[model samples]
Target: MSRAFTREVDDAPPPPILERAISSARNLVTPNGARQIEQAMETLDRQIEASGDSEALAALRRELRYWHARHARMEIVEPPEAPTIVTFGTHVTIKRGGEPKHLHIVGEDEADPAVGTIAWTSPLARALEGARPGDVVEFQAGGREEEILVLSVKGASQ
Candidate 1:
């Protein structure tokens, strides 16, 4: 084939897929959150070592990159010196419609609502940040506004 008919670029493999958005920007994290990031890196490293499948290794590497970036810029913030209200790394129990619900306000990467944790940047958490026990906070959910009564506060998570 002539030079004009052949292309060198076609011989090269496509670039690896990456989730770069996950690795951008630093964020405040709790000690546990920082630990979680470290744990994730460790887990990915082990998986990458043990996996023989190319696809699995690629996925693990992508996860490792995310965790590495997270760990690199993670800023660990201590819990409130004196706990009088809700803040990052603390669990706040609140009641809506007399039904109690507990939410752990944590770093963005540690948020898992199924386990009762929410990111501090979430709307509900933002509204509840400066509130104390017995304080009522108005939160919007599903396009509707509701009131939540703070029942208690759990000490910061380790």
Candidate 2:
């Protein structure tokens, strides 16, 4: 048999790997967001220290990479000195769809709607950024469009 005909053949080429995606938006973080990232890193470090499985360690490393990037770009925006007007780290109360909603404008990582915190870049927060008490702002949420009234503007503390 000819060498060319007798040569062993590889069955198939491996599938292409798609690289993980990362956000390009500015990593704007509140004090709490920064703290959360730090806490995550600490936890990841502990896991990495105790882990012996190669696959699990690889996954942890991937997460560490993301957290590292977030930490590097972290911008801790403190509450505005006066907080008279709505801004980052400001707490605002609004009436949306006739229901009262109290939320704080925080960083994306620190957002927890169940806890009454929304990311600053969120549509509702953007709409309410400059609004003061009694000012009505339009909001589009859950495919429904409506106006939200700013009921009150409080400092970040409250």
Candidate 3:
């Protein structure tokens, strides 16, 4: 049977860098991995069908199918437009105590603070969003008040 498809948020745009990351992840899945997952699903389906005994197993199958469909839908969704504010997919440069730092604002799935990419939900990102160049933003981090001045904002790109 063909799977039924629906989106939870029809109008929501995907996070740009996140979409790219997801695409990369999907691409990285080897043929063997795909075959393995398919094999597992088929086995599970067969067991569930034969048993006619486990609602939990059937529910698990439904959840797995839902996630698979959601992932596929996300792959096709257009990314959010680059925002003037410090939103996901924005590259922001800032200065703190005369030291310059750069951060790529991305979704939680793509956050990598070691490389300076931070999630938009982070305290620093929250404080920096909507701030223009030269605007100082203060937030508590590591139990101390940290201040950063926005130096620039642009879309994440080469």
Candidate 4:
């Protein structure tokens, strides 16, 4: 039982959605996510040791674990607070190309462009950040420049 458990842990890739979320979270330096990754690594390490795996498996696990740990340590600065200006975690309403929309400027990990959660590093987010209500912003993407007008900026809580 222990051997099988070990082998399974050794062979398993990090959960895909978790990895994507973690990768995105890493880009923003979310302390909570970093801690979660550390805890997960510790769990994986114990499993690998108990499995008594071959040297190759051990090495692979070690490398993957190290990569996750190193990535968690990358610096991610928090977005500045601008109640009136759009920033990370801020919910902004805008009119883009004649369509009205609401978007949340979030960390890379939390970005879901399809659902209007944009990463702070994305061109749209970068262009929108620091903008206040009534401000007009022009962003160029895919070889074309698009214009948007900030209609409102509010905290995530609201």
Q: Which structure among the candidates has the greatest TM-score?
A: 2
Taking every candidate in turn, the Cα RMSD to the unseen true structure, in Å, is 3.5, 3.9, 15.2, 9.4
For candidate 4, lDDT tens digit of each residue in 1-158? 56655766778875432222234334563444355456667777677767765664556476566647556555654444558788766789999979999997765544678998787788888899899999999989889988899999987345
67-140: candidate 1 lDDT, tens digit per residue: 88888788998766557789887778999878999988888898899999898888888999989999999998
List, in order, the clash count of every candidate structure: 0, 0, 0, 1
Cα deviation in Å at residue 106, candidate 1?
Answer: 0.9
lDDT of 3 by residue, 3-67 (tens): 34655575576433222122323222222334444565676667666665456565656645643
Candidate 2, residues 73-139, lDDT tens digits: the string is 8888888755667888888899876799999888887899999999888888898888889898888
Q: Report lDDT (CA) for all predictions.
A: 0.84, 0.83, 0.61, 0.70
Ranked by TM-score, the better of candidates 1 and 2 is 2
Residue 55 lDDT, candidate 4, scale 0-100: 62
TM-score of 2: 0.83
In candidate 1, stretches whose alpha carbon ends up further than 4 angstroms from where it belongs are 1-15, 23-26
Clashes of 3: 0
For model 1 the TM-score comes to 0.81
Q: Report the C-alpha displacement of residue 117, candidate 3, in angstroms.
A: 1.2
In model 3, residue pairs whose N, Cα or C atoms come closer than 3 Å (at least 3 residues apart or on different chains), thus clashing, are none
**Lowest-lDDT window of 10 residues in candidate 1?**
17-26
* Comparison by lDDT, 2 against 3, better one: 2
Worst 10 residues of 3 by lDDT: 18-27
**Could you tell me how far off, in angstroms, the CA of residue 62 lies in candidate 1 after the best superposition?**
0.7
Candidate 1 residue pairs in clash (backbone atoms < 3 Å) = none
